[model samples]
Target: MSTELLAVRPDRSLTDGEAALLLELLPPERRERLLWQAEQREPLCAYGLLLLALRRRLGWRSLPPVARGPAGKPFFPDFPEVHWNLSHTAGAVLAGVSDRPLGVDIERFRPVTPRLLRRLGADSAEEALGRWVRLEALAKQSGTGVIAVLNRGLTAAEEASAHDLTVFPGCAAAVVLGEGEAPGQVRIWTLEALLEGLAENF
Candidate 1:
């Protein structure tokens, strides 16, 4: 199964007007769900990144209808074979799609203090940050929220399935794919490029 990833820097996140245009492309239900967070830029920008990746990798002309899993994770019902997940942090936003199920997470790359390590229940600074993103990806892959996986350790199989990502300069990211599947490098897009994509005929 091929897995594709895309990441955007927070510096390049969309403006309200650009987000509104992407928002119009969503199905009514999804659009309604986002209206409440109209002031929140990350989700809108992250979702727009998802659509951009879908169009590029899957050759999708128009977005397929979206459905939510029990945990409120969105999926393409008509494209059940297609799996995807989105994530964002203070540093960057990411989108991933694959033929098999996948989950992704990105976190700002900041120094972790001993206190922070204690809070994360990890041994070292790097371990703390690494585990943080791992648990997030696993939770997302399982359709379980991040809270459910917080403080959780990776099993042997999980360790093998997860891959570290180096997309944005100030971010640490991770992605979980089908057990034993390899996650390749990401496709980085500038905000201007994504905006250009939005201007394309759908």
Candidate 2:
């Protein structure tokens, strides 16, 4: 399989193979849930399809039925060995998978209002905003969600210090578990390019 830096996009639709792979990973009940969501169209497509693509890409053997914790974090029963995290806002969703535990987040490149920034800010310093977001993303990936990080800010300082940060100037934002090494670089996949590649492959 070509591991040439997977760059899935917000607008690219899933191929039949991709969709089948997603269904294969989902448990029966979750399959129903995904099917129900798929019936709605548009936004769910970006979230669901990308999720399935990532799940397949990571070679998840099987997933437990969707189960939630008291804190409402989602979990899989069968594949606890694989760390998985999901985040989506406005136009896109991100799924990060890693062996060493990982978290990912994506945010559109828009101005963060000063007031909102102060309220969401993890620290008083401006430089810490990315750190805060990274921490939040990491927490989400860890199944603790932002509340855990927001509540206990100093914990997981080592993982939070993962400095492989990059900015994507497009319709969405994404963060994923890093291999402790910042990717030498990232490649962007436009919606058209992705569709063309799929077509050519077929």
Candidate 3:
């Protein structure tokens, strides 16, 4: 039952294994988004699949369409009662769903370039960016795009006063799931496990 982290490919499109799994779960239009760029497409599609699967697992009829806020945070329209987050990095994307406000992040284990760091932000600024990442991730989880909620003034940092922010430095993606309650627990699973489960069900 041990789950090791799986890497996603940015350049490659979704694999047949992934595509087929998605096909079985997603409607035709939803499945079309899986083409191109693992960096963006794969994770987003996977997130959609996960949401659908979770709805089925929980016995919900359907989830609200993904929507974004002013600062580029994703949210659920139908299930305004639930909070969620989504994040994608070099090779992987992570998503978290909960009844409380939550944020999840993953960063690939790589050195931060001085130039990128300089432009991105400094200590507090970096923290703010991190917060922004969580916020944006939340928007994605809600099924909304980041641009709708992308903005400034949000602070980052693991210890920030923010509710439930989960950071996964290993893969390089951050997510924030915010709703009625802050998360009291979290479950971490490898992308491979999700894919395997998807494949088996398909």
TM-score of each model, paired residue for residue: 0.86, 0.58, 0.55
Clashing pairs in 1: none
> Considering every candidate listed, which one attains the maximal lDDT?
1
lDDT of each: 0.79, 0.49, 0.49
The residue ranges of model 2 lying beyond 4 angstroms of the native Cα positions read 1-7, 12-28, 31-64, 111-113, 120-132, 164-167, 170-202
Q: Which model, 1 or 3, shows the larger TM-score?
A: 1
Cα RMSD, model 2: 5.8
Cα lDDT tens digits, model 1, 1-202, are 4888888775755676787787777777777888886355667667777788777777765577889999987898998998889998774789998888899988886789887798787887677888788888988898987776665656789778878988876677899989768878898877777767966845
- The candidate maximizing TM-score is 1
Per-residue lDDT of model 3, residues 43-117, tens digit only: 654464455446544654334466656655556666665665555666555555555555555554555556545
Off by over 4 Å in 1: 110-116, 119-126, 150-152
How big is the positional error of residue 37 in model 3, measured in Å on the Cα after superposition? Answer: 4.3
Q: What's the residue-level lDDT of 44 in candidate 2?
A: 35
* lDDT, residue 163, candidate 1: 85
TM-score of 1: 0.86
